[model samples]
Target: MFPLGDTHGGRIPPLNQILQTVQQNTDSLKTYISAHHEIAYRSIQQHNAQLAMFAEAAKLQSRGLEQFLVSQEKANLHIREIVGLDLKALAREKQAELGKEEMEKREPMLRNYVHALADFVEVVGGRETQSQNGELNVAASVATIKKAEVKPRVWRRG
Candidate 1:
C-alpha cells in the first residue's frame, strides 16, 4: 500500500491552534462590543444635538410670530385713529357741532371703535388661539358697524 502514516497530515498540531482560535474569537467579540458601544454613544450625542437645534428654531419662530402680532395691533390702532378722525370731519361738514345729527353720524364710528377695541382686547388677552387674522378683519368689522342705523335724537336747536 502507499505511505499512509505521515503522508497528508500528522494530526496537524491541534492543541496550540485550538488555543489560538479560542483567543481570536474572544478578541473579536470584545472588539465588536467596543465598536458597537462607540457607535451607540455617538448616535445618542447626535440626536441630543439635533433636539437642541429644533428647540432653538421653535423659539425663534414663536418670537417672530409674536412680533408679527404686535405689528398687526399697531396697524389696527392706526386705522381706528384714522376712522375716528373721519367721523370728526363728518361732524364738522354737517355743522352739527355735537348736535343730534352729528351724534347720529358719529354713532356708527363709535360702534366700530367698540368692536375693534373688543377684538383687539380678545386677541391680546393671551387666550389660546387668539385671532390670527389681525387687522385684516377690521374692514369687515367697520362695514358691520356702519350697517346699523343711528336713531335720530330729538334736538332743541339752541
Candidate 2:
C-alpha cells in the first residue's frame, strides 16, 4: 500500500492557509512596533521641554540672589555712616551740657543721662550687649562715644 517514500497519510496542511496565518502575525507585530515608536518619541519631546523650563528657572534664581547680595552690602555701608554721624552729635551735646554753670553739682546726673542714651542705642540698634564674660559692657560702649580719649580705666564700670 506504500506509494513512494512519503510517510504522511492524508492530514497535510494547506500551503495557502499557512502563508495567510504568517502574514496576519507579521502585520500585527508591525502595528505594535509603530505605536511603540511614536509613544517613545513623544515622551522624549516632553522631557526635553521640562528640562528647558527648569534651566530657565535656575538662571532667574541665580540673578535674584546676586542682586540681593549687592543691595545688602550697600545697606550695611550706609548704616555704618549713619552711626558715625550720630556718635559725633552725641559728643557735641555732652560738651554743651558739661559747660553749664555749677557743672560739678550736676556732673553725676549728666553722666547717668549719657550712659542711658548709649545703652538705649545699643539695644535699639541690635548691637552686641555682652562683654567677654556675658556681662553688660556699659563702659565699652561709653569708650566708643569718646574715640579720641585714652582713659580706659575711668570709664570702666566695677
TM-score of each: 0.45, 0.51
Query: Which pairs in model 1 have colliding backbones?
Result: none
Model 1 lDDT per residue over 56-154, tens place:
999999999999889766775655553443433332444444567566666654545554544554444343223435434645554544453332232
Off-target runs (Cα >4 Å) in candidate 2 are 1-12, 84-89, 97-158
Output the lDDT of residue 40, model 2: 99
For each candidate, what is the lDDT? 0.56, 0.54
User: What's model 2's TM-score?
Assistant: 0.51
In the order shown, what is each candidate's alpha-carbon RMSD?
9.4, 10.1
Any idea how many clashes model 1 has?
0
Evaluate residue 120 in candidate 2 and report its C-alpha lDDT on the 0 to 100 scale: 57
Measured on C-alpha atoms, candidate 2 has an lDDT of 0.54
Spell out the clash pairs found in candidate 2.
none
Q: Candidate 1: where is the Cα deviation over 4 Å?
A: 1-19, 86-91, 94-158
